[model samples]
Target: MAEALADIGMIGLAVMGSNLAQNIERNGFTVAVWNRDPGRVDEFMATVGAGKKFVGAHTPEAFVNAIARPRKIMLLVKAGDATDWTIDQIKPYLEPGDIIIDGGNALYHDTIRREKALRAEGFNFIGCGVSGGEEGALWGPSLMPGGAPDAYENLRPIWEAIAAKVDDGPCVTYIGPDGAGHFVKMVHNGIEYGDMQLIAEAYDLLKRVGHLTAPELAAVFAAWNEGVLQSFLIEITSQIFRAIDPETNQPLVELILDKAGQKGTGKWTSEAALDMGVPVPTIQAAIDARVLSSMKDERVAASQVIVGPPTSPEMPDKGDFIMLVHNALYASKICSYAQGMAMLSTASRAYNWNLNLGEISRIWKGGCIIRAQFLDKIKQAYHRRADLPNLLLDPDFNQWMADAQTSWRSVVSIGALAGVPLPAMSASLAYFDSYRTARLPQNLTQAQRDFFGSHTYERIDKPEAGFVHTEWKELIQ
Candidate 1:
């Protein structure tokens, strides 16, 4: 094994894997190669790694045997159950203290479970969330790693040497404890859902109300990048809008559908929040929006799909309505992040994971899909106080929301008047206002409790609880 890979490192190359391997090799790391398909490695070396020396392994055992001493193998595969099977396949041959990183979206619990199982086998496991698209992989990524702190230290050279730089530099850190890394990535994806929904809502308003072309919308997004909205999400939205439809010469966006896809992370985040009793309204609604979108044909068949209002059905108010939508989107986005991070904070406390919210936000600043200007605020929000309940309540963020509420309200009302569902977006702002209101609709709430949990209710202005003069509660009293 030493002779086979002593000089450098090894990579398992797929399209992304190949680019990433070349990235590692380009940085002067020796990269041994393997794949489910042996042919792909040869092709990758020929094209991406041109003239690079690479070792190929025929089997998982042989692959483990081929790495150099104090053995280390980084597993880059599809996330979840598949990741576990890959680790299990390689475990028998890995020696004590050998490091294996699961660089995919395995559940944090799974990471913790895997860490325990492998450590008991005298091997160390690191669950790493490697972000940045292929580009980030080749250049550098925002790496969130969790496991034994010593194991992270052992792998720091590789992570730091291959990560993006912040003012603080190098977007890599030990996210603490067994599952913190995956947990951060989970929140990362949850916020991502809200961010995408915000963008889509923006596009929907601009297109529907302003009658803006894709190119026009793209230009607007590009300008946003120069302002408070400046971030990766806006940058890409600008580019995506500019793409021309070759046949029609119109913006390519018109050719696209109003549907989006997810690979379970968003749903998982919402589900986890519900289980923990966290009020993650924005993130949960984001998931619901996608589920509703996916039921397109069935919805149409059932006459359940409806687009309520025209862009400006009332007195040429389209522009005002559009601005309001933007405000609503922004505020709701804050709610989503707050909810997701709150969940992380809760899990961290209950599970004893001293997760760093500041570090997590900083990584999302650059690489990976969900990168947005809002993340910078989030980083600042947490940096100022690690224990902040949520980003919206962060002092500066609250100021921003206070300034933006009128616009948000206008947008929600316009959407309502115009007859757009605006359910997720409007509901997001509703969650925000509700959180801050110190009061809510509990008129039916007490009835709901009495109906099921049999809890007593209170008078409208009284602190004292009184059971309703209903059959069950009155008899029990």
Candidate 2:
């Protein structure tokens, strides 16, 4: 009988899986890699896996056997049924207490269900959120693992070794038990959607209002990358603008279609927020923008039929408008992240996860797509007050928002006048305003509801009194 040689095993051989396997091996762990299709295993072994510390397994039984007991296996399979199918194939061979990790973008509820089922069957399951795209997977990625504490302790060495390091610390952490990791990842992606959309709006304003060419825009983004907006997405956006299209002999972004693609993670975030009664308007607007973008045919038809503003607004000083855009983007980003943080806080309490917001923000400062210079401020804010209800209430952020409010309002107004859809930015501003307002018009809505259905509402004047119904029409009569 062959001896168990591999320290850990990975079951998928797609770009993400292959890169992660190589990363593990690079960290000095002997890794066993398998693919559902044997040919892929062969191809990877010959190419990316060649001369690496990798053991190619032909079957699920062989894959399980190659790993040392109690084995640690990660699945980078498709999120839904595919993950389940892969697990079933390996379950028969897995011994008691072996850890199986779902490293894909899974729905948190599904992760919870799987973890519970696996635990009942005398196994440990971890729903780990792996972020940082193909390149990050190959080098280092931010890892969010949620499971039993013992299970995390077992995998800690490997996770910490392969995670991106920032400020002399790893970007991997043991999130709370069960689905917390995946839930955090979902919100991360949702926040990423908002970030991308906000940056896109800023780019549009730079081009249309500021009259900056692609190269100029690229330079602007590069400059922003050195400032408060320094982030992976912003840095990439600069590089993307600098790319030239060979076929069109023009800026690549200019030649490409405006439509965007999305997986269901953003929608999941919005749906979960709705279910929890948490308002994530910026993230919701980002999802809506993507959905609207998908209707390319309808949009094309509408573009021809619907008349927009008669004239485009020209910025008196392009430099000054550019600064306004920077302020607007920064302020809007604060609102977007605040909304996501609120959702996380709500989920933490509801699920009894006891999440560490500061740690989460700290780990997100590197390797993840949403990693930003701004995250350090968030970490500090949470460290100062762990139970902060909203980031807008934080002293630093409060002052920043107050200082930038005029610029943000001007940018949104200009977009409106120019007939450009700045959904995320506008929604973020509205969310901020709505949150700050002490007295809302919802009183009138409550009165209307009571008049129609006798649904009661609380009275401000009647202290200590519960909900009361008033015949509003009778008072008018």
Q: What are the Cα lDDT values of the candidates?
A: 0.75, 0.95
- Candidate 1 whole-model C-alpha lDDT, 0 to 1: 0.75
Q: Residue by residue across 421-452, what tens digits does model 1's lDDT show?
A: 66667767878878887768786787677667
Residue 120 lDDT in model 1?
86
Off by over 4 Å in 1: 1-12, 302-323, 451-453, 456-477
TM-score between candidate 1 and the true structure? 0.90
In the range 335-423, model 2's lDDT, one tens digit per residue, is 99999999999999999999999999999999999999999999999999999999999999999999999999999999999998899
Q: Best by TM-score, which number?
A: 2
| Window of ten residues with lowest summed lDDT in model 1 | 1-10
Q: Highest lDDT, which number?
A: 2
